[model samples]
Target chain A: MDTPDTLRYTRSHEWATDPADGVVTVGITDFAQDQLGDVVFVELPKVGTKVKAGQAIAVIESVKTASDIYAPLDGEIVAVNEVLNGEPEAINAGPYEGGWLFRIEPTDPSAWNGLLEASAYEAVAQEG
Target chain B: MQRTPLYERHRDLGARLVDFAGWDMPIQYESGINQEHLAVRQDAGVFDVSHMGELRVRGAEAMAFLRYTTLNDVGRLRVGRGHYSMLPNESGGLVDDLYVYRDADDDFLVVANAGNVDTVLDALTAHAADFAVEIVDESDRWGLLALQGPAAAVRLERVAGMELTSLRKNATRDVDIGGLHVRVARTGYTGEDGFELFTAWDDTPAVWDLLIEDGALPCGLGARDTLRLEAGFPLYGHELTSTTNPLCTPFAWVVKDKPFFGRDAMWGAPCDQRLVGLKVTGRGIPRQGYTVLDADGTSVGMVTSGTLSPLTRESIAMAWIDSSLARDGTDLAVVVRAQAVPATVTTPPFYTP
Candidate 1:
C-alpha cells in the first residue's frame, strides 16, 4: 500500500527505483508482499545474467503459494540479494527498503519512462 | 459463495478469505500462518470450523447400520465417546475420514469433511435402505469451533464455568456456556490437548466473541493445515482419496478385524505402495505432486502433503512410495522445482505435544 512517489511500478506489482548511476534497484511492491503472505524462499537470478523486460527471472515461494518475479526492463543482473537466501521474511517486514531483490544495469535507462508512476500504480493496486 | 455465521467476524479481524469447498472461509489472520501455528502449539488458538459437516444417525438399528458402512468397530464406541473412522468405498478406498460420536444408546453424530459431506451422505443413504436407521443432515443447524493448544482446556474451562479435569479424551458432554447450549468434545485434528465446541448456528458468533475475549487467538485454515501436517494427520483429499487405500497407510488400525463393506476386497489387496513420512535432508520444500525417487533417482511415487514445520523448524512431508523402499531411514529424494532434494524415509507424526 506504500507506493513511494520516487519509484516506478509495473502492472505485475514490482517496483524499480533509480537510486544510482545506470543501476536500478528492483523489488516487489508492498502490495505484492502483503498478498503473498509469509515468504519462505526467494529464488533470485545469478549475477551477470541477461534478462529481457517482462521475463521471469526469479521465484518467490510463500507458505501458501509460489509466484514468479519478472524483470522490470531489459537489463543485465549486476547483483543479487543474497540475504534473502537466509532470511526471506525480510520481504514481509520491509518490502521497500531491506527486501530489495536485485540490482540491474539497464540496457536502455529510458525504459523507466515507460513504466507506471507511483500514482498510476496505486490505481492498479486499488483495482485489485 | 456460502458464508459461515462468523464470516463477518473474520472480515472484521482482517482475515484473508479464500474459497474452500464452496465456502468463503478465512485462510489466515493478520498474524500470519507461522505465528498462528505456533500460537496453537504454545498457547490457545480458536478456529471457525463451521464449514465442517455434521450428520445425525438415530434409530433402533443405528449401531448395526454404522458397523456395516464404516471401517471401524462402531460397537466399541460407548455413549459419550467417539472414535476416528472412515467410510470405505466398494473398492477398498475411502469415502471420507470422519469422527463418529455415540451421543445416546440409539443415536450417533458423524462429523465429516466439509467437501465430502454430500458424498458421504449419499453413500450412507444408499446403504441405509436395508437398515432401520434414519440419517439427518444437521450441518446447517450447528457451527463447530475448535479451540486447540496446550492451554485450550484451561482457557475453555474458565469461559464455560465447568471443571474439565474429568472430561476424558475423545469424550463429549453437553454443557451451558453463558446460557448458550453447547457440546464440548475432547477431540481435535491438531495433536494437542483441546476441545471442539459445537453450538447452534445462531449462537456461534457470541461463543466465538466470548472465547476471543478470553484470550484465544483467532486461527484460520492455513495454520490448521500446518498444525495437522506437523502432527502427521492424513487429510481426506490428499492421503485418503477414493483411489488411495487405507490399508497401505499408518491408518490401517481404523480398519478393524470385523467384516465391513470393503473387507473382501481389502483382504488381499495388492498394496505395492505404502504411505511414508519424509524428512528433508537437503534444501527445498517438498510439495504435493512432487515426484519421489530412489537412490538411483528413479521415480517411485509422489508427495501427498508437505510443509516446513514451525515447531520443529525442519522440512517434513508425507509421501506414497514403493513398499520395498518404505522402511525407516530409506534414502530417497523429492523433485522440488526440478531439483532432486535429498530426503529420508521416516515415520509420520513429526511433532508431538
Candidate 2:
C-alpha cells in the first residue's frame, strides 16, 4: 500500500519514475501486484516499439486471471525486464524495485503532468 | 447470497469472499492460494464444502431405483462404501457428477454439485413414479468439511478420537468428535489421502474449529480448484457439461455395462471428440475456452480446464479435441491471446504425492 512520492501513477495502477537521465522506469504498483495474487507470466512490448500514452504495452498474468499493463505516457520502448520471462514472481515480491517492466524515452516530457502524484493516486487506490 | 454456517469465521479470518453457485463463500484465506495448495499437498488442509448438495433416498426399491437412474452400478456397492457416479440425461449428456453412498439395503445418499442440486432432484423425482422410492433433499440438514493431505488421517485421529486404520479409500464410518456424532468418509477431490466429515449444520463450526486447532490449515475454493485441476479431476460445469459425454473422457470407468437412463443413447453417441491432457511446451498459460489447433494451424478443440500447476511449475490443461489426434505425444498448439504456443498431449494427472 506504500505509494512512494518519488513516482507518479495512473488510474490503471501503473507507476513511472525517472531513475536516471531522460529514461523513465515503468512498472505496476504494489496494490496492482497484490490484487493479482501470484504472478506467473509477463509479456512485455519489444524494444524500439513506439507506444502511445494509456496504451497496453505489457501483460501480467497470474494463476487466476490476466491483466493488461498500460503505458503511463507516450514513448518509445527502450528496454524491457528480461528476467521476468523466467521469474515473474519478482513483481509480487518487490513491485517497486526489481519488478520494473520497461524503460521508455518520453515523446513529451509534459506527459508526466497529466499523471497523478502519490497523494492523488492514494485516493484512487482507496476508492477502488 | 446464501451464507454457510461458517461465514462469520471466514470473515474473521480475513478470507476473500466471492459468490460461488449463489453462495457467499471464501475464495482464498489470508495466506493466499499457492500456500494453501502446498499445505494440502505436504501437510493437512481443511475446506468448507458445505455448499455441496446432499440427497437421501430410502424405500423398498432404493437399490434398484439408483441402479436404473445413475451411470454406475450402484448394486455393486455394499454398506459403508461409495463410488464416484453421475446422473446422465436421456441423451447421454451429464446432469451432474456425484458420489453415491449405499448406507444400507434400503437407504442411500447422493452428494451432488451445489449449482445442479435442484436440477438433479427434479430429474430424479420425475423418474421415481414407477419405483416405490422417496427422494429427500437433505442439503440444508448437513454441513460438509474436507480434510485433505498425506497427514490428514493422523491429524484427524487426534481430534476425532477414532482409529482410522480400518478405513480404506472410499470407506465411510460414523465417529464422535468432541461428543458430537459425525460421519467420516475416506474420499476427497485432491487425490490425496484424506477424509470428508459430515455433521449436523449447527455443529459444523465447533468441528471446524477443532480441526483447525489440531493443526489443519483452513483452505478456500481457489486452492480447491487448483488442487483438483492438478489431480486431473473433472468438474461439473468445466469438464462434464450438458453436452459432454462421459464415455469420451478419462472418467469412462464410472460408466458400467448395465442398463441406465442413457445407456442406449451413449452406445450410439458419436464420439468424434475425446478429452485429452496437454502440457505446455512453450510460453503462454492456456485457459478455459482457449482454442486448440493442430499442426496445420486448424482449430481442432477447446480447453475445458487449465492452470499453472504449483507442484510441477508447468502450464497444464485439459481439452476436448478430435479423438484421432488425442494420443500421447501428439503435437498441438493453444491460442493464448492470439499467440500460438507449442503444446504436447500427455495423460494426466500432472502431479502425484
Candidate 3:
C-alpha cells in the first residue's frame, strides 16, 4: 500500500526509480509484493540483457501463486539485486528500498515520463 | 460467486479473497500463508471451511448405501466415528474423496469437496437405486470450521466447555457452543490434532468470532492447502482426479478389502503410475503439470502439488510417475521454469511429526 511519490509505476504493479543519466532501477511496487503474499523465490533477469517494454523480465513466486514482473520500458539490464536470490523476503520487507530487482538503462532517457506518476499509480492500487 | 457467512469478517481482516470452485473464499490473511501454516503446525489456526459441502444420508439403508458407493467399508465405521473415503467411478477412476461420519446406525453425514458435490451426489444416487436411503444436499444448511494444531484442544475447550481428552481421533460429539447445538468432531484435513465444528449456517460467524477471540489464528484456504500438502495429504483435482486410481496412491489403505461400487474397476484395473513425494535437492520449486524426469533426462512423471515447506523450509512436491521409477532414493529432476532442477523421489507426509 506504500506508494512513494518519488517513483513511477505500471498497471502490472512494477515501480521504476526516477532515471539518472538514462538509468532507472526497477522493482515490484509495495502493493504488488503485498498482493503477492509471502515471497519465496525471485527469478530475476540476467544483467546486460536487452528487454523491450512490457516484456516479462522477472518472475516472483509466492507460496500460493507465481506472477511475472514486466518491463516498465524498453531498456538494457545493467544490474540485478543478487540479494534477492537469498532473501526474497527483502521485497516484502522493503519493496522500494532493499527489494529493488534490476537496473535498466532506458533506450530513451525521457521515456520515463510515459509511465504513471505516484498519484496515478495510487489510483490504480486503490482499484483493488 | 457464492459467499460464506464469514465473508464480511474475512474482508474486514484484510484477507486476500479469491474464487475457489464458484465460492468467494479467502485464500490468505494479512499474515500470509506461511504464518498461518506455522500457526497451525505450532500453536493453533481456525479456518472458515463453510464452503465445504455436506450431504445427509439417512433411512434404513443408509449404511448399506454408503458401503455400496465408497471405497472405504462404511459398515465397519462405528457410530460417532468418521473415516476418509472416496467415491469410485466405474472407469478405474474416482468420483471424489470424502469424509464419512456415522452419526447413527441408520443415519450418516458425508462431507465432500465443494466443487465435486454434485458429482458425488449423482454418483451416490445412481448407485442408490437398490437401497432405501435418502441423500439430501445440506450444504446450505451447515457452516463448517476446522480448528487445528497442537494447541487446538486447549483453545477449543475454553469456549465449547467440553473435556476433549476423551474424544478419540475421528470421533464426533454434539456440544452446545453458545446455545447453538454444534457437532464437534476430532477430525481435520491438516495432519494436526484438531476439531471440525459443524454449526448452523447463519450462526457460524458467531462461532468463528468466539474461536478468534479465544486466540486461534484466523487462517485462509492458502494456509490450509500448504498445511495439507506438507502433511502429504492429497487434494482433489491435484493429486487425485476422475481418472486417478486410488490403488496407486499411498491412500490405498482407505480401500478396504470389501465389496463396493467400482471395486472391479479399481482392484482389477491396470495402474501405470504411482504417486510419490519429491524433495528438491537443487534450487527452484516444483509446480503442477511440470514434467518430472529421471536422472538420464527421460520424462517419467508429472508434479501434482508442490510448495516450499513453511515448517521444513525445503522444497517438496507430490508427483505421479511411472510405477517402476516410484521408489525411495530415486534421483530425478523436475522441469521448473524450463530448467531441469535436481530432485529425489520418496514417500509422502514429507514432514515428520
Best by TM-score: 1
Regions more than 4 Å wrong, model 2 = A18-20
How does model 1 do on interface RMSD, in angstroms?
0.9
Clashes (backbone N, CA, C under 3 Å), per candidate, total 0, 0, 0
Estimate the overall C-alpha local distance difference test score of candidate 2: 0.92
Q: Candidate 1, which segments miss by more than 4 Å at Cα?
A: none
lDDT of 1 at A37: 87
RMSD in Å for all candidates:
1.2, 1.6, 1.4
C-alpha lDDT of residue B8 in model 1: 98
- Per-residue lDDT tens digits for candidate 1, residues B1-353, read 99999999999999999999999999999999989999999999999999999999999999999999998988999999999999999888889999999999889999999999999999999989999999999999999999999999899889999898579999999888889999999989889999999999999999999999999999999999989998989999898899778889999888888878877777679889999999999977888889999999899999999887777768899999999999999999999888899999989889898
Q: What are the candidates' individual DockQ scores? A: 0.70, 0.66, 0.85
Winning candidate number (DockQ): 3
lDDT by residue for model 2 (B1-353), tens:
99888999999998989999999998888788888899999999999999999999989999989999999988999999999999999888999999999899889999999999999999899889989999999999989999999999999999987799569899999999999989999999998889999989999999999999998999999889999999989999999998889999999999998888978888678889999999999988899999999999999999998888877788999999999999999999999989899999999888888
Go through the candidates in order and give each one's C-alpha lDDT: 0.92, 0.92, 0.91
What TM-score, computed on C-alpha atoms, does each candidate reach? 0.98, 0.96, 0.97
Q: Per-prediction interface RMSD?
A: 0.9, 1.0, 0.6
Models sorted by TM-score, best on top: 1, 3, 2
**TM-scores of the first chain across all predictions?**
0.97, 0.96, 0.97
